[model samples]
Target chain A: MAFQLVLPDSKSVSQAPSPLAYAVDRTFFYAAAAGALAIILLVIYILWEIGGQALPAIGRSGASVLVNTQWDVQNSSFGILPQIWGTLYSSLMALLIGGFIGVSIAIFLTQDFLPHSLATVFRTLIEMLAAIPSVVFGLWGIFVVIPFVRPAADWLHDAAGFIPFFSTSLSGPGMLPAVIVLSIMILPTVAAISQDAIGLVPYKIKEAAYGLGATRWEAILKVILPTASGGISSALVLGFGRALGETMALAMLIGNANQISLSLFSPATTLAALLASNFPEAGAIERQALMYAALVLLAITLVVNVAGTLILLWTSRKMAKA
Target chain B: MTNASVLEKPTATAGAAIDCNIDKIYYGKFLAVRDSNIAIEKGKITGFIGPSGCGKSTVLRSLNRMNDLIKGFKLEGNVHFHGQEIYDKGVDPVVVRRHIGMVFQQPNPFSMSIFDNVAFGLKLNRFKGDVEERVQHALTRAALWDEVKDKLKASGLSLSGGQQQRLCIARAVATQPSVLLMDEPCSALDPIATRRVEELMLELKNDYTIALVTHNMQQARRVADITAFFSVDISQGGRTGHLVEVGPTDQIFDAPQEKLTKQYIGGEFS
Candidate 1:
């Protein structure tokens, strides 16, 4: 037998593709590059707008915009203190009211405490309510909330008129109506997000809790709620963001006065409401002032979103470690 | 040994064994498991052997009312634990499960430290003794104390696969449940891990009544005192599972009553 060198077939060698074929997959590379570039440009544009106008207004106004009680935009005197205070106060009120009701509704939905059909109907109603326009809510606030709150305002004014905060002028549509409208607006967001978060808790963990002789309430309190805490926090942050940025509803309901008052029944203006009421009438410096207000609102939203992201990341990391 | 004696006290003789009769139906029509019955003697390990979708897991889940979690699952039968009807309206399933602990197929240690995982049941049940001591004792019983004692505070997920399975077993037994239900506890483990779990099961039988579901016939022979064989009847178009035969492990292996049992033990169709 003649010893002959055996060689591998060239057919298999020819079948293997070059590295460029793997590296330059067209569809994926194009989509990824486009997404990255779009995000970069969006961030850059936002920074430029804020830097060009908002910073200058803030620097010029200094502590007066934050501390002074007056805002006379026509006469070139713009102070945001009252608007800032009103925004904080109303948002806090809305959070307190919405948080309680939303979490309760979420618990009810997840715990099978309601009939399945009823739960479904209620969930649908909430979703529809969420999708309803803010302008419609504002109209409802004007027509219904004002009349309903007038009696309560009268009672507070009669009972505690000596107190500065309760010296209610029995105003038409003001802080109280605005707060109520905001609470209703934020409710569906909080409830829907919280229900989803609670739903994401694994069945096994809940089953383990039940298997350990825990009561239904005990299992929810200890296992379900703790596991879903990060998600719930995100939900609350989302609701707060909505409350902060709400403009049309607040403008329609909040009497549109640029004065800070401790009374719930008094007329007050949030930053959003102020911008909505004055942005159309603003001139050179006034436009810059409105932009500054927008910047502040944007900063607040960014902080909330960043905090929510951090909380979610920390929770997932904790879960991974566990 | 004292703990073993406590578990063996009621069912010292074969006449006093707990009998489980489970009939399960899904949605008013589909039968998941039909007229399944088993006698679990105290302090003995009983294994259910079957193919996929063979109702072994359904029967196991029914022992502790874990089937109640399923939306349309309904059961009509008696599971007598110390002569009490488990399915009675007044009897709480949570309370029943407390006394009849369970270990799932996956090593589902909670998202907590090893110490906390072992302590979970004790705290839930308000077990009012020294928590540390109980956790240690349970860990020791599950044969995981030696490897994990120094790292009790570490995350339970930090353990190896075998160790996590053992940790779950330890957590289940921590509540001092008289009966333990394990649903293919070693199916996810490797060969070495499987052997370790088998050894642990044997040791556990001295102090707990164990009902195990396994697809591995050899594992059934190795660990079970009694073996119940189940098969899905696919002739009806949709699958419905039923128990084919059940008896002492030795009898099932040596002289099976049914041809299917014989074929199964002979490794013909497993």
Candidate 2:
């Protein structure tokens, strides 16, 4: 196709560009550019400082720092294998439990399972769960949650004792309670975002499904949920981030045991838990070890957030095309 | 298995398939529409032509209990579909909707693969046999089989506007509904896509009782066998829709009994 310069067929237009307008435009552009640069500068500064502080530990431990279990103070050796496993296992466990609960709450609120006024009240209560400080949750986990959950842990140990994950004897403050507390703390983050995602579906789409003879459950499962999958995945990512970086609550209740074990009943120390509990009493090498663990947390969060954003972007572009 | 010949079998035979006597419709005490009485004939296309907010779409939606979805929407009326009172105390809207599928004002193919969108209803209802065959038949009937047969796995939204509408039509027809309600099915398309959708509606009427709500008088004239004219009545609950006339398409267009109907069709008023 040949391109044609189609011009407006009528009136005279102003001929000259104003110098004042150009000045104002340039000033505004530079102001916005400066704001963006500040954020980049701040992130770089934090990463550089943390990396420099952690360099001593990183050089001494080599690649084995991530996988080696022992954290000997006298031997001057430090590794985070148990902490890494603890962080991964606890966060994954939290996701499995919290993700289900959050999605369920979101679905219930969005769908017609409850009356309008009732759903609103329930939604508010669930959102309120997020507003309470993490320290408060930590206290609750120590006193009430740990005691209340011991029986369930004992029951799991008895029922599924053949499995390595369930072989350990029950304890009040360990991986299981830590997982429970993390799941609770992250519930609102997951539910709130997932609810928003579910709400984004248009009424016309639901009407189309209903017109196709789908039951409410069928329509929800086959259409609405799939349509909101991107948002839900983003919610899970946020939940995972919250669970992974959680320090105060895990440090308070996790018993901070620094050894890897297959059993869920065994006490464990997550990266955040170890850093939070040991940072205040750290010597030169100990401080570097804590900073090393913090760097890993930072890297993981950055990766997770980027992946989550890409997922959201992909789904939105697909939605726009549709 | 042949597409055109299979859809050639006429479905509706005689009088009314859907009989409506809607006294009023309300959204939380705010009256939306009121007083509609019409007999939608079987095996033919019945066109509902009126201005905006004339309750043409409302009446069509009521036929299959689609109003049940709205939070505060309630209607005082009886709508009987194929001799069953659909508004009865013990009626399941799911079953009612299965028998009378609808096409929307906008093309709304589910955000899924073309083949999957067509197969959704069958899967939901747990079709016992040959899902792929049924999907193919539906697509073929909608006259989209030739264009999209090779791209069954492609997203339904990937198609052009006209093809998307046809895919939606295929989706609606997949479950073998006896009656099809369309609310301005061509309003969102270009002239070419509009013409294609209009043609598809005419072909589908042979196998389904079609109720269409349209603002386009030319479309009504071209496709409708029977026509219902509605206009806003100010006296009964303030600007509520009332059915003005219903008759054979030719008579309504050429020799309309109601002056309002004449004015509407003659372009005297909206």
Candidate 3:
């Protein structure tokens, strides 16, 4: 009976459908559907749980929680404007640096600039960078990146002290070091996705470009890059999201100062860094505030991912129309 | 004077547009095709027809160094265009392709406007002429101007399959290349579209040397002034494709010298 319903046009069956087979099929379908529905519910549950814990702070501060930049513990006034700014600023800077390098690496690997075997080797090595633990990246930044960026930061401070970006001296871990480490940390995500995007461009389209006598750079710059721009842009957006939420490396390297400074050498804090460092030993009000900040980070990441997805869809439609 | 010139049919010049003396074509260690000697005569249409895996497209791509884009693609041969070796150490493949343009099997118009697609080559070659006039001339020659002249700003991908193919042809001709290599240009279109493209080829032969790879025997007989036959040999533990015979289209269709060519044209393998 179930066979008739399921395979209405398949008349080659010699025997009637077994009830056991029908039961198995129904059970498998329900199991898979349950798995899918579970994830959706879990996501909503996480948002609800975080929002519920953050309600006290949200009710106390309201929209001012985002705009105010005070965090005095003795008098009990808490505002996370600097952390919000740091998160956005650092992530954008990282995206600019990492996004350029990542897309260039992707193009170099995918556009026949390297041998096939060498490309595979380099791709594997780049992806392996993602597997390293966040704490290890933090340790590496403290030991390696901090040293490398300090002298340059000091040089810029000395040579071009009039510029706001280089006005502060690099006495310790600062925004420049954190930004450099964060950029390196996000390189794998950007490069891998961009490589996939560039590689996915149909071979036929590339052949058409070359068939017209376009040199390598011409074909790449005029045709391949434009065709893959949507994917690359989305990749950068996702990288920005990753950089925004990065906690350990930024916390270790950003010096955790709670002020906004124009100088790249000034200490700063991010939302993720603030949450990770403060949540361990917080009083009643501060804990709620920390949870509220976590919610903001989640909201920012959610917005970025949604925007990235929309950009992907829009560009694909435009590409299809063309 | 115009009436008398129009009455006279265009004839093939004695000069060879692209001459090839190929020993072997290989992808890494595997021999793909071998032992081909052919010359595309100026002001005529030459067709390369054979069964699948016969390396007709391989030889066509080798003429313009398009195969150089493929990894492990190595050719032990010399392809000369207008008496200059294309595969020499100093000859840039880019310059070779600029002079010897190609149309692929698929109508691969770029993701750009119709006018941009036709002008892509002209811009690459740095043509200092009036771009709009040149684009119009190419479209007119490709027989696509009547259909697409008004919508020149429309995306090339928006057109029908046949129109897109003609757009590719127009793009190829807009560069004013001395030779055009077409690899099965009509296999993707309907009979009517194929007829239109074939007519465009006949009209184009007056100005450009054309080499075509076709699967359809009747299409070759209809449009090609000369046809080259290729067949694959499996006796060597691998399918090695080679040219069998090349002659006038009438001789190839009516009386082929080689048994493989005769069998292929006679529908023995189909």
Candidate 4:
């Protein structure tokens, strides 16, 4: 395309549309709408392809394909229950731990308690933490984090052994290790989004708090946090999404066990991990089982993402009212 | 200008509400305000009139130690509330702020219910009386209760600009502090709303001492007992604001001692 020199000549013509120009403009409008429609078609096509491939496995067991735990490759029986449990609980653990740490870091950095120059430096460091490759975190977890978590896991087992969640004994890579590494991996993502959300709160609101004789802690807790809650939650949603789909990091540390365990110390596998590990070696039925698991993961992600968006909208409406 | 013109006539210690002996305020090394002195009188309105960036708002903020939040903000001064120095060692800014409340130029209502907004200061101070009655009393005193009595639970932001300002006034007044600092409180309001606020200020003077910073000369003439005019002094490094004249409202407006104050009030220059 060449740059053309043209000035807007106000005197040349009226803004009223000509017949030919109107037809051309109408075509352009339809063209743009079709471009948007292409995305919807693409999503539907992928879903159809996946559904067709997995239908045989789904038809054989019906709902048991989701609930059954048996995976006998010799007899060709499979279930996604353990992987589902692993994915859900591990992602929840990651969200709780990572969301807490992310929000705390965001609050600390955004508060006026620190000098502006120093806050800027700390914020930059956290962003850099977010940019580190996931495989490196998984590797670091293998060498450094696994050792640290072992003693903590043992102590947890001893102190709360009566509890089902803390009953298992740890040897190496497991659910807890995977959860911790995932949490750390998502921390900066959460922090970065939360920083933006907290930063979006108007300065005048904080001033209002201080003007009413509020301490810095009071102002932040009572005013700034509530005002930024919508954005903060969106940050959490992004973190949750990232944790749900993360493959290399969780796959490396999850120990790739196919059985479900209530204990944090027990080894586990996730949907992404199962797909990564088994897809290369699987026969038709096993491959179908993995596809079914991926379908379930996709469904869960959609439900969760919709719920998060609704919650965010609810908070924003409340903000508008208040 | 004469010394008395630069600094207000010294009121008795017992009668002064808040007094400032400010050497300078600085952002890093750049001075914002220099050599300022003023004594606000008890149960009366003292008005600060000046052009923009003349440190009038800075002085208003300094009264409650609100400037402490700004990075690189350094002040060489002592602010006394009644007889005790507010910036003295062991005097917490939080506690100092509780004794003196401020209203901003913008009507910044907390993002909560109107009832909660009125109750914010009372709860902060741990008011040991009937909370509901106190909120009602404060709102009534701010002249917003009659309009918003039924919808107390409505969000503070749902109110009009003027009503929000009144809500803020009610919030500040709920603490029942000795001094009320208003920094152009009516600047964001409509003319009718501004009149209402001005009227409310006159009524409030019966119970509270007010130090007002305003851009409106007519507002000062109508409501202030003492008027202090500030002007920017431009020199080599930067412009520094300092008090140019201080006297009774009529004298300051009718016979401004400094040429700059005359230029300002006479509309010859800002």
Candidate 5:
């Protein structure tokens, strides 16, 4: 026989699965659904526990807890406005520095600028930064980062005294060191994810760019960056989350001062740092206030996550339309 | 082999747009193709027709130095574009590509708006003229202006497959390159789309020299003025591809001198 084109019977094929396979398939589907439901339930349960514990503080102080800046343990007046400002300010600063460095590193590694072996080595080293424990990072920040940064902070304060960011003289652990440490802490997270995003851009798209007489830099800046923007932004958001939740480094480096000031050299405290520093030595009412502060931090993080997701959706839609 | 009897000698004719004289093309010491000579004449469509694994695409890619992107792809030969040695040490490939644009086997438009896709080359070259006018001119030349005129702001990928391929053609033509290389431009398209692209090629011959690598013999006969045939050789225990013949399309299809060409056209083997 020369050849024959045999057509499968669609009716038989659709119904031909073994009974065991059907049972296994259904079982897997139900198992995955249950796992997803469990995750959602766990989140709700945690929120419930935190909210219930924070209720005592919320009832005792009302809205005064948010706007109050003085935290006198003896008088039991707990105001976390300064800590909230420090938390937002520090995380945003970390995001700006870390996001730029991470995206640059990702582009450098994935765009064939480095030799393959060298890129691999650099990538591995960057990833290993994440494996170092947070406490170790804190210790490193206290010794190496603070010492190295003190002179620069002092010079900035002297030279640019009129600017509020550099008005205060550097005495010891302060916002500058804390921001620097937080930035380094989140760099690996941002860089690794960004590398994956940039790497996933199709080779064909890059070729199209080069075919149009684009230099390597031109191709990367124009074609590859825009194509990977969505993924890169997601990576930044995750890095932001990592920076916001970091406690050990911030508690060790930030001066933990109760007063609010714009100077980077001035001591400051974040919500995570406040919780970590005050919970152990707190009396009963102070514990409730710390719990309430934790709840505020949780709300802020949730809002950031939601905003990131919305930004991603809006960008994709804009890209499609444009 | 006896087939060398019909092979054309390397000639640098005045009308040639791109001239290639090759001793060997190797991917990391493994000989992929050898002993090839082909010239793409100016203002005419030259087609490279060959079976799979015959290195037609490899030779086509070498003309524009697009093979430089591939790791270990080495061409031990000379490829001249309009009397300039494109592979010379000091000559930048980016500058060479500016004058010779290409359309890939797949429709590879950038994930950008249609207008931006066409304007990409113009922007890179820093064209001082109106970009909007140039984009419209290219789309009109590719026969895609009417359908996409109102939606130039839409993403290039939002179009149908045939439209996307045409959009890519417009993108390549927007920079006004002298030579256009199309590697299997119609292989991914339907017959109707293929016919439209063929018509576009016929219209583009007035201004640009085109080099095409195609698997379809009918397509070669339809649009190509001259055709180069490449075939694989396994007699030496390695399947190294080499050029077999280069002549007018009618002669290649109807009065081929080589027995291999006759056999291939007679449907003896793919």
Candidate 6:
């Protein structure tokens, strides 16, 4: 026998849910999204207000503020060229010294020359160094590095005083200490990241090298290092960025001088050190000028970060194709 | 078992060839390969076939001292390559490996161009004369030149699986080693690629001694002039691999002396 079937109404099926419930769900989602948008907009607005107030000071002060030698805030005069030079010069010196030591340590740790247990111990020590705060490093630098470096600075002043770089008076805390402190500060960052990069090189490739009769050093130089070049570059950039923006440590050792000197032992100031030293007591105009310094710092960091991102993207693309 | 005991001693006929008598142990305790013996002809294809954990690969690796990479691995017997003990204290593994190249189970081409990968070994050994010509010659010998000649600058990874394996083979052979060890070189390839590799191997044996470790018995039967079969015994607390038989491929398949060999060859034990 054939059975008859019944069909439900399409209108009731379509209208099963209450519109209020839908409205409540939609409202919650929109509210959460709007809250996130508000936070972002608030941050952007604050930055814009600060940046707008600071940029005009540079224009009012003119190219002298950017390229002049003196930074006398008392006479309504301000120049950051010396400070900029100090910052770049010290950071570059730090990078060169720190980068060499850090990459060497990384290679030693990752290579087969050392015993496994010793390598582990060395790696652990480096990681611990990274955990020490910048303030602690500053204190250590003042107490320990100053005495040892004072003699060297004096020697440079006496022996090589004919050279502009070595013409400093060699009294106390200065570019030499600042550069040394910055180097020690950035050491852990470079070493740890470089070791991590070297470790990321696949074992299979090294084995392939060995299978082809490559010596331990040959395998590392030809196969492992090239494969890890991108990561190592990123590590170096990270160290550079850290050195560029370091504040408390540099301030403690940089002597707070705005005069640029060619000598490693001479007194000089960096932007962060300058900001830290005088930001609390600065008047409205002085504060705006300091903010302009901050703005310059921000621009420099932004450029560095953008460059790092581009490098990372290009390397990843190359790796993917490889 | 009686025949295995007799085969433990080197054949008097192989007076001038390389003999690898590998007794592998793991952790300084567990015996992996027990009294295994094989004589490698100077320029011929010899295939080793066994089930998983049969220690065929261990014996293959012992020839070039590849087993030295493993921690706590020890060997009791000697592997003599051209009458010189490979395990001697002064014998450098690097120099040994330079004269004896290897291809792995997987196609592990470097992340460089096809030309560069082939040129890697030569450069590592500091081959100073006409590198381009040597690289081209190696590529042609490995049967990869025609396919990759136009794209030598392309990354080795960009090639198909077969092409990559051939590229690896080219890289290995470019060093002009006397012996070429292949650890299941065609296992990761398709049937067509496998056939191409097999043909290449046959062609290569004329110039270099070839030792192959494979699980595919048919591949062993097709390409190997001599075949060695290994089996595992677990009663010894650790897996003990022993060479059950070694002979010409036809004799081993048609008239195996032992019942176990017959069972394995007739496909009775799945």
Using DockQ, give the best candidate's number: 2
DockQ of 6: 0.54
Question: What tens digits encode model 1's per-residue C-alpha lDDT throughout A1-322?
Answer: 3234456764433343455675567768998999999999998898788767877788888657767777776677777888888888888889889877888889999888887899989998987888889999999999999999888789988998888867777679788899999999999999998898788777777777776667789888877887788888888888888898899999999998877788888999999998888878788898888787777777787787788677767766765554
Model 2 C-alpha lDDT per residue in residues A1-322, reported as the tens digit of each score: 3233456874667344567777888999999999999999999999999999999888878788887798887877888889988998899999999999999999999898999899999999999998889899889998998889788888989999889988887676788888898999899989998998888887788999999878888889989999889989989998898898889999988889987877888898899998888888889988998899899988887888788778778877777776
Q: Residue A318 in model 4: shift from native, Å?
A: 6.7
Instruction: Report the lDDT tens digits of candidate 2 across residue range B1-270.
Output: 232222224344358888889999887877777788888888899999998888888888888889888878898988866555777765677777878889998888888999999999898878999999999999999999999999999988889988988999999999888889998999999999899888988888889989999989999999999999998876655667778999999999999999999999899989
Where model 3 places Cα greater than 4 Å from the true spot, the runs are A1-18, A313-322, B1-14
Q: Best lDDT goes to which candidate?
A: 3
Residue A162, model 3, lDDT: 97
Stretches off by above 4 angstroms in model 1 are A1-36, A74-77, A111-121, A152-170, A259-263, A313-322, B1-17, B23-27, B146-154
Across A1-322, the per-residue lDDT of candidate 4 in tens digits comes to 2233455765654345567877898999999999999999998998998888888878887788788786677888888888888888898899999999999999999886577799899989888977889899899989988998899899989999889889888879898889999998789888988888788777888888987878888999988998898889888987897788888888899898888888888899888898888899999888887778888888888777787678767766765554
lDDT of 2 at B12: 46
The true-versus-predicted C-alpha distance at residue A30 of model 3, in Å, is 1.7
The prediction achieving the highest TM-score against the true structure is 3
TM-score to native of every candidate shown: 0.86, 0.92, 0.93, 0.89, 0.91, 0.86
Q: If candidate 1 were superposed on the true structure by all CA atoms, what would the RMSD be?
A: 5.8
DockQ scores of the candidates: 0.44, 0.72, 0.62, 0.56, 0.44, 0.54
Tens digits of lDDT, candidate 3, B134-165: 99999999999999999999989889999999
Give candidate 1's TM-score.
Answer: 0.86
Pitting candidate 4 against candidate 6, the one with the higher DockQ is 4
Full-model lDDT, candidate 1: 0.83
What's model 1's lDDT at B126?
Answer: 80
For model 5 the local lDDT of residue B213 reads 96
lDDT, residue B14, model 3 = 54
Tell me the spans in candidate 2 whose CA falls farther than 4 Å from its real position.
Answer: A1-32, B1-14, B234-237
Superior candidate under DockQ, 2 versus 3: 2
Model 4 CA deviation exceeding 4 Å by range: A1-42, A309-322, B1-12, B235-237
Positional deviation of B30 in candidate 5, in angstroms?
A: 2.1
Worst 10 residues of 4 chain A by lDDT: A1-10
**Cα lDDT for residue A309, candidate 3:** 84
